[model samples]
Target: MPVIVLEARDFSSPIFLVRTLEVISGCITFSLVASLEPPKDPSDLHPTFRIFCMFIWCFFFTLTLLIHILSIIQFHSLIPISWKNLTVTTAVLGALMGLSASVVFPWMVIDHQGSLQRPVAAAVASCITFLAYSSETCILRTQAQEQRGYMGSNPGLLKILQLWGGCNMIPLVLGVVQSQWSALGTPSGVLSWQLWVSAVLYSVCVLMSLVTLVVILGDFAGRCFLPFDRFLAGFSLIGVFLYMFATVICFTKILQLKEPGNRASAQMTELIIMETVVASITLLAYTVDLAFSIKLLCDRSHA
Candidate 1:
């Protein structure tokens, strides 16, 4: 007998697939980049990191686009089509911002062997971070709230995400200032100083991002308020946060070697160990998150 199809509130399985793609791609890119030899000095910083970020940006952007397309198709057939804060417009804005950070800025802000690509990239990335992150938190908040009382959930988790957004923002803005000042003043000592500051800013923001995840995930597991499914949502965020944290930690340690000629030294070896530890934590986080996202989607569909 042919099974009859029922109207579903969500197109769960595809969302799962898309998210998995993002995670897998992000993980592969991160692992490969982490394995590379750390370079010496700020000049060496520009091209490599920029290219790496750009690749990540493009890959995620594609996934984002595909998800949206699939979403439209699914909504047309199953659930009512709705746009929360994380709408198509929001995704576009986030994508553009990410692209600027990954592709535009490094080219603009950092000089490749003494030539500038374009300085606006860093500034644009900052602006994008503020907007993208703010919108994303808003969407998460709405989702959590909607799921409230259904399976039990806490709205405060969204607040934590928002706070993390603000925290991560601080360094990005500073990074821009540092990049800009160094670009214009063209001071000899200022170059290293500003570059280091920018790195520090990004590093701090990345750390806060991870901490934010830790808080939310803590709530998800123990706080009886979160619906069983939304807990799954928290998992991916935790993983992504940790992955970012680990990668940044490795980069930050390398940035500390400012005097030149000591990038791949014994200190770097220790840093690599640290990076490995962080990566392990992140991957674990990712695994937990994948479980949550999948479970949430499945539950929501069945419910």
Candidate 2:
């Protein structure tokens, strides 16, 4: 008889340590949000913002916690794990945490009402948290690429994800620019030229997603190096949903901005909703797609 012994090694991975810190940061932010008093002024701030912030914080906290637990299991040799999938998840978490750092400011405003200290500290902590996760992602990715020839399932889907990811940056960058320079004040309503710009950008995002879905599906057999599975379809659908929702939100915000009596507080609320929804969905879609692809790669490696 032959004996085979498998020892778990995930805890020794540097990525595991980074994920632990990320979870801690999420918990700190979540606790702070929970302890804050309810919004005093309904007109200036809505309860929904606080509720949304809490939801996001909780989501991040729970996700990291679960991932950490799974890592521990894999480390103990209780189960096998895919390093590539974990790396993708970490990369996605880094993106979401970066967005979380930005998202905290609005909640800070509602919670602290002009105090700079608490919000700044939280934001800095969140930023550092993302940086740590990002560092881990880079390290894992470098290691993977060194061990494996390339990181993706096939050249085709990899190209699509790369292009799609790059295109997404367009909206992200433009939104940042618009927010920073928004005080210059553009025209409102359908007459708002900036509104048209937003409309066009989001429209492109939608069109691109749609086109990607069709192209990937129509020729999936020929193009995919891996099996054409439901995961690919699900991932493509998420992309489409993300772009469609973003397009609708862009138009809605334009209309809201044109409203005669719309308060600045209301505008800020709308912005928060839009940014949070878009960022969350985008991060989720990317994470799932990469995770599935990585799973396939892991299967190959195991085989």
Candidate 3:
């Protein structure tokens, strides 16, 4: 259903409609999985229960990795750019970025069981996510710069989704780090520094997203989109949407369960959602307008 909900919009409306229907059909799938475990009674449950919850959590996380890989392929298909006949480097980086998380989960959860290996694995994954995204963003900026004088229709939607999708991983990285910042109920978990560091880091991710959106919008407005291009605007807009949506989902889930341990988590969640929702939704509207404009550009070219 998560796959279908997102897949519905990538291309033809009929295809999207089919995906939407499929998503609806899978409501039972989500509910069934969610209902499997008894609700956590925060006061009574041992910390081990959270580990059990995390084990079940891997299935959904795997789906996200799948989505990231799919977005990479789809975005690559949209771009005219390439690497030795391969599509944009962005796609390649995205594939690696997705793998980072996929690998981290099994290594930390199944193989090592929160032993020394877990933190080591997570730190490696964090570095991979960060490097992949930053490298991909640099590639995109280069692509736009190379096409500086050659104006055509804005970059295709695929490129937009790919690039921004890669760029959005920083927030994912932060949230993941925060979630497993330490081995809970232990000295590491009790440490104030870890929570404060994560709070600050995630907060930075949120601010970076806002900056990215603003820059993308300004590019469309000022018509300076050479590297990332105006079409990247839609990608940026979608990135913002996913960022905000994920932020909200995380906050709501944590709060509903009353498990966002530190005061920082609660305060940061509120701050992020409030600002991100307003900015992202507005940019989304602008992106739709730009998409229609792209159609006009295509029509004129055909004419």
- For lDDT, the strongest prediction is 2
TM-score of each: 0.32, 0.51, 0.28
Q: Write down the TM-score for model 1.
A: 0.32
The alpha-carbon deviation from the true structure for residue 130 of candidate 2, after best TM-score superposition, in angstroms, is: 2.0
Model 3: what TM-score?
0.28
Give the per-residue lDDT digits (tens) of candidate 1, residues 1-303. Answer: 333332364435443344444444444433433344344455333443455454544555464555556554544233232333233323333433453344333443244324222233333433444344344434444455443222113223322333333333343333433443444454346445644553554455356545434443333335546664465466456545645654565465446555565434442344244434434444454555456567668877999
* Model 1 accuracy (lDDT, Cα): 0.43
Off by over 4 Å in 1: 1-43, 75-119, 122-126, 144-303
Q: How far is candidate 3 from the true structure (C-alpha RMSD, Å)?
A: 15.5
- How many steric clashes between backbone atoms does each model show? 12, 0, 3
The weakest ten consecutive residues by lDDT in model 1 span 148-157
lDDT of 3 by residue, 31-132 (tens): 333333333433322223234323323433343344345543554334333322122332333344334434433433233232444444443443444344
RMSD vs true structure, all candidates: 14.4, 10.1, 15.5
Once fitted onto the true fold, the runs of candidate 2 whose alpha carbons sit more than 4 angstroms away are 1-13, 43-46, 73-83, 104-116, 145-303
Worst 10 residues of 3 by lDDT: 148-157
lDDT of 2: 0.52
TM-score of model 2 (CA atoms):
0.51
